[model samples]
Target: MSATTLLLVTLGLALASFAYGRSRAYSVARLGGGVRSMHSLPSHYGMMVALWCALPALAIIVGWKLFEPSVVSGFLQDYIPQSVYEAGEKSVELYKNDIGNLVDSQAIADIQDPDKKIAAQQLASMRHISSLALFVLALAAAIAGATLALKRIKADTRARHNVEKIVQFFLISCASIAILTTLGIVLSVLFESLRFFQEVSIIEFITGTTWSPQTAIRADQVGSSGSFGAVPLFLGTMLISFIAMVVAVPFGLMSAIYLAEYASRPVRSICKPLLEILAGIPTVVYGFFAALTVAPALRSFGATLGLSVSSESALAAGAVMGIMIIPFVSSLSDDVITAVPQSMRDGSYGLGATKSETIRKVVIPAALPGIVGGVLLAVSRAIGETMIVVMAAGLAANLTANPLEAVTTVTVQIVTLLTGDQEFDSAKTLAAFALGLMLFVVTLCLNVIALHVVRKYREQYE
Candidate 1:
C-alpha cells in the first residue's frame, strides 16, 4: 500500500480507538457511581488512546517514507549489468534514472531488451511487496499502541498529564525545525562565501570602486580579467534605500497618525483597506508602472523644471518602491498608535493640552517603540524588493550619491551573477553567495535594532 492509503487506514483505527476508550472509561466510572471516580474526564482518556494509536503508526509510516527511495535504489544494484555498474558516479546516477523511466513508461511489451524488461518486472514486484509489508506493520503498531493505552486506562491514570507532555514535545519539535533551518542557511552561505574569498581578495571586493566580475577562461585570455569591487553596488543600494525611506516614513507615519487619531470610523474603515490594497498588487505590476509611467513622468517633470534626471534614475525607483512599502509602514504604525491607552489621551485633555499636542507628546512617545519596529520592517521590505528596482533603476553600477543618476543595487548584481548558463566554479558565480552573506548581515542588524527598540519601550509601558 502507498503511504497515503496506510495513513488513512491508521487514522480510521485511531478514531475507532478513541470511541472505544471513551466508552470503556464511562463504564468504569459508572461502576464507582459517577465520573468523579476517574482521575481525568472520559474525553481525556479518549484523547490519550487516540494519541497512542496515531503517533506510533505515523512515526513508522514517516520513517518508511523517508527511507523508501534509498532502500529501493539499493535493491536495484543487484539488477545492474557489470559494465554499467563499474562506471563513475554520474553514470550510476543516470542508470538509476533510466530504471525509474523504464518502470514508468515501458511495459514488458514496450521493452525491446529482454533483460531490462525482466529486471523492471522484478523491481515492480519487490516494491509492491515492500509497500504491503509497511502497510501491515503500521496497522499492527497502531493496534498494539491502542490496546496498551486502553488496558492502562483506570481511576489512577494521568491521561491529562500524558496528553500535555505529547503536545509539548510537538511544539518543541516545530521550534527546533525553524531554528535548525536558519542555522543551515547561515552555514551554507558562509561556506560558499569562504570559497569565493579564496578566489578573490576580500579587501579588493569590499574597497575597490569598479564592479566588473568577469574571470578569464585562460590565464592569457584578454578582457576577461575582472575587478571585484563592491563599493559602487553598496553605495547605489544605500542611495536608493535612503530615497525610499525619505518618501515612505513621513507619508506612511503621517497617514497612520491621521487614520488612527483623527479620521471618523466610517472613513477609517473604507480608506484603510483601500490603502492596503496597494500591498496586494504584484511587484511586477509596480515594475511596469515604475518603468513605463513613473520614469517617463519624472524625466518630463525634470525637463520642465530645467533639471537633468536620467531616463532610469534612482529617484524614480525609490519613489515607486516607497509607494509599494507604504502599507507596510501605515498598517503597522496605525495598529501601534490605536493600541495606545485612551486614558492617556483623556489625561492630556484634562491638562489643557490640544489634540495635536497630546499626540505629539503623550501618544506618540507611548507608541514609539512599535512605530519604530514597523518602520524597520518597512525598510527591510524596501531593501529586499527586486522587481521595482530592476525596472525603474537601470543596471549601471554607477558610484553616485545623486538620486537623479542611474545606479544598480547589490540585489541586481546578485541576480546578474546567478542568471544565465554560467559555470558555478568561477569567482563570478561565487560572488553571488558572498553578496547574499553581506545582505543577510545587513538585514540581521535591522532586525536586532527593531527588537531592541520594541523590548526597551515595552518594558516601560507594560
Candidate 2:
C-alpha cells in the first residue's frame, strides 16, 4: 500500500477511537450524575483512552517502517550470486541500489539477468504481503484496545488518575528526549575526536604552540608538520570574556539600580525596554560594528598612545561582547533587586541611613547572590559566543597578554577547524570536539557554583 493510504488509515483509526472514548466517558458521567462525583473531568478520561489506543500502535508501526528495509536488505545480501557480491564493495552497492529500484517499481528490467530478475520479483511480492499483514494486525490491535478501554469505563473507574499519569509520563519522556539528544551530540563529537586521536597523539595536538591546520596530503609534500597548540586560543577566549565582563557588569548593574530603585514610573517604563532594544539587535550587526567601527577607532587611539596595536585587536571584540551582555546582566539584576522586600529598605532608612547607604549596604548585598548568578550566566554566554569574535578578532593564534595584539579565541578555532571540506578523522576536525567538550565542562561547573552561591545567600535573606 501507498504511504498516503497508510497515513489515512491510521488517522481514521485514531479519530474513531477518540469518538468511542468520548462516548464511554459521557456514559460514566451520566451514571455518576452529580458534581464533585469524579476524581477529574470526563474529557480527560476520554483523552486518556484515545492516547493509549493510538500511541503504542503508532510507535510499533514507525519502528517497523524504520527497520524493515535494513533487515530485508541484509537478508537479501546472502541470496545474491557470490561473483556479484565479491566484485568490489562499490559494485555490490550498485547491485543493491538496482534491486531496491526494481522492487519499488515492481518491474524487473534493471535486474538484466533472468535469475536475478525472478528473485527480485519474488522478494518484492513477499515484502508487500508482509507489510500489508503487519499494518492490518496493528490496526486491529488498536481498535480492540480502544474497545476494551471503552467497555471498562464505569462510574467508579479511576480513569482520570490514569489519564493524568499518562500525561505526566509523556512530559517526562519529552524531557528525556531533549537530554538524550544532548548526550547523542556529545557522544558523536567524542567518537570523531577519538578517530582523530588515532592519527595524531594527544600530546602533539594539545601541547604544540603553533596552529597551522593545513597538512600536506602526500608523503613527500612540504609543510606537513602542522602544529596544534590550544593554549593561545584558550587565552584569547579568557581575555575577551574578561574584558566584556568588565564593561558589562558595572554599567549594567548601575543601570539596573537606577531603573529598579530610583526611576520615576514614566522614566522606568520608557528606559527599561529602550535599553532592552540593544539585546534585540542581531549579533551580525554587532559584529560589523565591532569590525568596521570599533576596531579602527581602537587602532587609531592606540597609535596616538605610542602603542603597537593590530587593526583587529582583542580589545575591540571584547568591548563589543561586553556591550552585548550588558542587558542580560542589567535585566536580571533589576528583577532580583526589585524583588527584595521594601521593608528591608525602610528599616535601613529608619536607622538614619542615607539612600545610597541603604542601597549599597542593605539592598545590594541582598541581591548579590542573584547578581552573581546573572554574571555566571553572562560568562557562559561570552564563552560560547561566536560571530563577534569571528568578525572583529583576528584569526591568528597568539599567546599574548597585550589587549592591543590580535588573538584567536577557542570558538574561532572551532569554527575554522570545522569549516571547508574537512576529513572527519583529521586532528583539525577533532579539535573542534575537544574544544566543545572543554567549553561544556567549564559552563556546567560555573552553573553549579552559581546555583549554590545563590541558594546560600537567598537563605540569609529568608
TM-score of each: 0.95, 0.83
- Distance from true location, Cα of 19 in model 2, Å: 5.4
Error of 1 at 336 (Å): 1.3
lDDT of each: 0.89, 0.83
Q: In model 2, how large is the Cα lDDT of residue 60?
A: 65
**Model 2 lDDT per residue over 56-79, tens place:** 667767887888778777777766
lDDT of 1 at 353: 100
Candidate 2: pairs in clash:
208-229
List residue ranges in candidate 1 displaced over 4 A.
106-108, 217-223
Q: Which ten residues in a row have the lowest lDDT in candidate 2?
A: 34-43
Error of 1 at 209 (Å): 0.9
- Give model 1's clash tally: 0
